[model samples]
Target: MKKPIKDQKMVIFILLSNVFTAFLGIGLIVPVMPSFKDVMELSGSTMGYLVAVYAVSQLIISPFAGRWVDRFGRKKMIILGLLVFSLSELIFGLGTHVSILYLSRILGGISAAFIMPAVTAYVADITTKEDRPKAMGYVSAAISTGFIIGPGIGGFIADYGIRMPFFFAAIISFLAAISSSLILKESLSHEEREQLSSNTTNFFKDLKKSIQPIYLIAFIMVFVLAFGLSAYETVFSLFSDEKFGFTPKDIASIVTISSIVAVIIQILLFGKLIDKLGEKRMIQLCLIIASVLAFVSTVITGFIAVLIVTCFIFLAFDLLRPALTTFLSKTAGNQQGFVAGMNSTYTSLGNFFGPALGGILFDFNIHYPYLFAGIVLIIGLGLTILWKEKSNEVSL
Candidate 1:
C-alpha cells in the first residue's frame, strides 16, 4: 500500500514545528550570552569553554542516539528528546550559578543530538528522493524563522534580565513537545521493523558501515561549514561591541536582520536551486559565496557594510545546510539515522573547535576570526569540488 502524500506533508509540518521550537530555545541565548558574561564576570576563554562543552557532549552521544532512533523509532526518540530539551531549558532559566548553566547546556546538547538527527531521518523516511531537498528547505526555513523571532524577543527580554529569555524559550519548547506528542506518527512500517528486529545486527557494526567514504566526505563538508559559521557566532557580537560600540539591542537587531535574510533564502531560493542545479552543485556555490562574503566582512569598515556582507553570509550558510543534508540522506541508503547522526557529530565537532579557534583569534584581533573562517571555507570548497567529481565518477 502506498502512503498518502498528504500524510507525508503532515509529518513534515510537525517536524518543522519541532525544528522551530528547538532552535528558538537556542537562539534566545545568543544575544543574551554576552550580557551574562558582563554580569557574571566571565572571561572570553571561559565563555568559549562554556559553549564548547555542549558540543563536546553532543559529539560523544550522537552516534549512540542515532542507533537508538533506528532501533527504537523516530517518533519515540523525537518525543524523548523534546522532553529532555524542555527540562534543560527550564533548568537553564531558573539557574543562578554558572555551573548550573554549564550543566543545562550539556543536557541540552544530549537532547539535541537525539532530536536533530532523528528529525532528519524521519524526513528522509517520508520524502521521495526527488522532493527531499524541498522538504529539507522547509526544515531550514523553520529554523531561520525561529531564529528571527527568538533573538528579537530575547533581546527585548534581556533588558529586564538575562534569565527571562530562557523562561520564554522553555515555554516555547514545552508547547512544541506537546504538539509533537499529539501529532507525530511512526514512519517505520511493521515489516521493516520486524526485519530489523529479526536480523539483530550489532549497533556498532551498523554505525561503522554507515561511515563510508562518501558519508565521511559529506560529514567533513558539514563540519567545515559549521565550524566556520560557529566561529562567526562566537565572535560576531563581540566584534560589533568593540568595533562599532554597539549595545546588546543593536546586536540583536543585526542578528534579526540576518535571520530574516536566511529565512527568505531557505524558503524561496534553496528548494528551486537544489532541484535544478543538484545538491552537490548548490553546496559548492554556497561555499564559494560564503567564503567571499566572509572575507569581505573582515575588510569592510562601516557597520552598514558589515551588515550587508553578513546578509550574504547568512544566505549562503542557510542554503548550504539543507542541500548538504539532502545529499547525505540520499547517499546513506538504509542507514538514515546513522548518517544523520554522523552529520550531527561533525557539526558538534565544529561547534567545539570553532569557538576555541574564535577565542584565540579574538585575543589577537577582532577580524582574525572572520579571516580564519574564510580560509577554512576555501578549504571546504576545494574538498567539495573533489567530492563532487568523485561522486559523479561513482554514479557513472
Candidate 2:
C-alpha cells in the first residue's frame, strides 16, 4: 500500500533547523577570522590557505561521502555529520595555534561535505516533484537566515573573546542534532534501500552515468559562484581596511546586511518568481545581476555603497542557488545522493581555488581580487548562454 503523504510543513521545519546549524557554524567565524589572524600574526596567504583547506578536504571526500549516503541513508549521514561538526567546533573553540585551527577547519569541511548534501537529498525524498522548488527555497531561506544572524552575533561576541563564537556554534550544532534525531523521520523506503544495497556497478561507472549534462552545467555554475564568493571573502576585510578605512566591525555589519537582504529575497520572493519565471531564466538573470553588482562593488568606496551593492549580489545569489539545487535534484531522479555529492565536489573545488587565487591576486593589489572575480563572473554568465542554447537544442 502507498504511504500517505507526510506533512510538508514539519519536514521543512526540520530541514530549516538543519540548515540553521550548518550555516551558523560556518558564518559565525567570518568576521572573527581576520581578528584571529591578526592575533596569531598570520599572513594573508596563510589566511587564504586556511579558508581553502576546508574546500580541499571536502573535494577529496565528497565522492566517497556521496556513495555512503546512497548506501546507508540520509538520516544516518546527517546525524554523523552533526556529531563530527559539533566536535570540530568544540576543538576550534579550544584551539591555540594556527595548526590546530587548520585541523578544525578540515574536520568541519568533512562534516559539511556529508551534512549538506544529505540534508538536501532528504528534502528531495520528502517533497513531490511539483513542490520541490518551493521546498528548496525554504531550505535556502533557512541558510540565508543563519548567514545573516550568525555573523552579527559572532561579531558582537568576538569583541569579548574569539573562542566564544566557536563555543556557541558547537552548542548550536549539538542542539540541532538532538532536535533532528527526535523529530526528523526516515523518508526512504525498504525497496529503495534494497536497490541501493543491491547495486553492483563499479563506483566510477556509477559516477559517470549519474552525472548528466544538465548536472554538469549546474555543477559548473555553482563552481563559478563559489569561486567568486570565496575570492570576495578572502580579500573583503583587507580591502575595507586598506582602501575604505573601515574597521572589522564595519565589515561585519556590511556582511550582516547583505545576508539579511539575501534572506528576505529567498524567503519572500524566490518561490513565486521561480514558479512564474522558471528556473533556467531566473538563474541566468541572477548571474547577470551578480556580475554587474560585482563590477560595481569594485568602484564603490563607502559603507553605504558596499551595503547596497552587496545586497544586490546576495539577492542574486539567493535566487540562483535554490533554482540550481532544484535543477540538480530533478535531474538526479532516483540517484539523489550521487547528485548531491557531485554538487558538493564542485563547490569544494571552487572553495579550494577561489581563496588561493584571491590570495595570489591580493599580493599584487587588494582590488585585484574583486576585479578578477567580476571578470570570472562575466565568463560564467557567458557560459550560461551556451548552456541555454545547448539545453534548447537537446529539447528539440
Question: Each candidate's lDDT (Cα)?
Answer: 0.74, 0.74
**Against the hidden reference, what TM-scores do the models get?**
0.85, 0.86
Off by over 4 Å in 1: 5-11, 70-72, 124-133, 140-153, 186-213, 271-281, 333-337, 390-396
Candidate 1, residues 162-217, lDDT tens digits: the string is: 78777767777778778888888777976775665565445466446544566667
> Per-residue lDDT for 280-314 in model 2, tens only?
78888988888887778778878788888877887
Show pairs that collide, candidate 1.
none
Clashing pairs in 2: none
Identify the candidate with maximal TM-score.
2
